[model samples]
Target: MKLLGIDLGSREVKVVVMENQEVSQQFKVSTMSFYRDYCNFTGKIVVDLKKLGVEDADIKISTGYGKNNTDLEEFETINELKAHVYGVFYQTELKNFVLLDVGGQDVKVVRVEKGLITDLELNEKCAASCGRYLENMAEVLEVPLTELAEYSQDPVELNSTCAVFSESELIGQIAEGAKLERLCAGVNYSMYKRLDPLLTKFKGKRLVISGGVAQNKAIRDYLKQDYEEVISLAEPQFNGAIGCCYYGQLTGEAENRE
Candidate 1:
């Protein structure tokens, strides 16, 4: 049976198709493109699965920021927290760990024990610790996002607490002739500082970093200093979508057996 999982995030929409417990296809689209071009928003934003080359999927599951706003018919909607935990469990065999998901708009720090979420900390109101902050900072520095990960060798001290204020501070650093590498490190460290408080609460031995920020090598390195084992999934950003497919298959299989 084929199952489809969709994670409608604030900045991006991730889709994953699974066939018999294995990932068959995956795609990602910017949230703007999705809403502007594909979404039909009379009552709720409905995505045309057929247009995406997905038809007759045995089960469809949705999660993330825009899940409730979607009008996808005959679909199951799951909470973001549940979907994240399931994603980690489905992808990795390790049951006890901490899951850190830094998306465009929010940062989620979750503790998973015995294949379930034990505790969680969510920072949805602030952009300082999220992927959008990094994107903005990279733009100000005139550097590509991918290159920013490698530019930071030694992190400088950045005192700003707000994302907007931090931009001004970074500008001043640029004016003062600070090395680009140090500036990049400082930006990464600044984000880490914002995340530290929430992460401290659910400090576990094993850490699983997911979402867009999971691709940042500097952040992963910083996290490894605190965590005994810091692991990154092959497809960190799509873990939630993958989890949705896994869940769909599990429930669909059970129903079929019944």
Candidate 2:
């Protein structure tokens, strides 16, 4: 069976095609471009699958930021947490693990025990510990987002509880002639600090990091100190979509057996 999964995030739209529970193809595009060019915003967002080069999919599922409003017919919608957990399990061999998904506008910490989510936490009130904060900081530092994770080796001291104030603090560090690498490390550390509190209540030996920020090496390195093993998905950004595909496959197989 061929399945199409779509994860419409605040910043990007991730799509994946799976054949017999294995990934066949995947693509990602900035949400702004997707909205402006491909989507028709008539009450609900609609995309032409053929225009997007996806056709004749046996099953279609959507999740993430705008899943509720996606105008795709004969589609199933799953919650982000379920999608993320399934994505992690499908991609890795680890059955017991914690899932950390830091998206453009929110962060989710999920504890998986015996292949099911037992506990979870979410920070939707602020973007401080999310990917958007890191993007803003990288812009202030005049560095590429891809390079920001590599710039931090030894993070200096930065104590800003708010994302808005952290920018000012970063400016002060720059004026103090702090090494760029150290400042970048400070940024990465600050994000980790924000995440640590939310994850403290959960106890999982392994961690599966997903989302755009999972691509950051510094964040992954810091996460390793706390987790027995820190695993990053092959396509961190596509985890949600992949999870949807997994869900589709599971149900499709069940129906066939029935």
Query: By lDDT, who's the top model here?
Result: 2
Question: What TM-score would each prediction reach against the true structure?
Answer: 0.96, 0.94
The digit string of per-residue lDDT tens for model 1 on 80-102 reads: 88878788878997789899999
Candidate 1, lDDT over the whole model: 0.86
Look at candidate 1 and tell me the lDDT of residue 158: 83
Clashes of each: 0, 0
The Cα local distance difference test for each model comes to: 0.86, 0.87
**Candidate 2: tens digits of C-alpha lDDT, residues 196-246:** 998888644778889988999998888888878888899889999999999
Where model 2 places Cα greater than 4 Å from the true spot, the runs are: 41-44, 66-71
Best by TM-score: 1
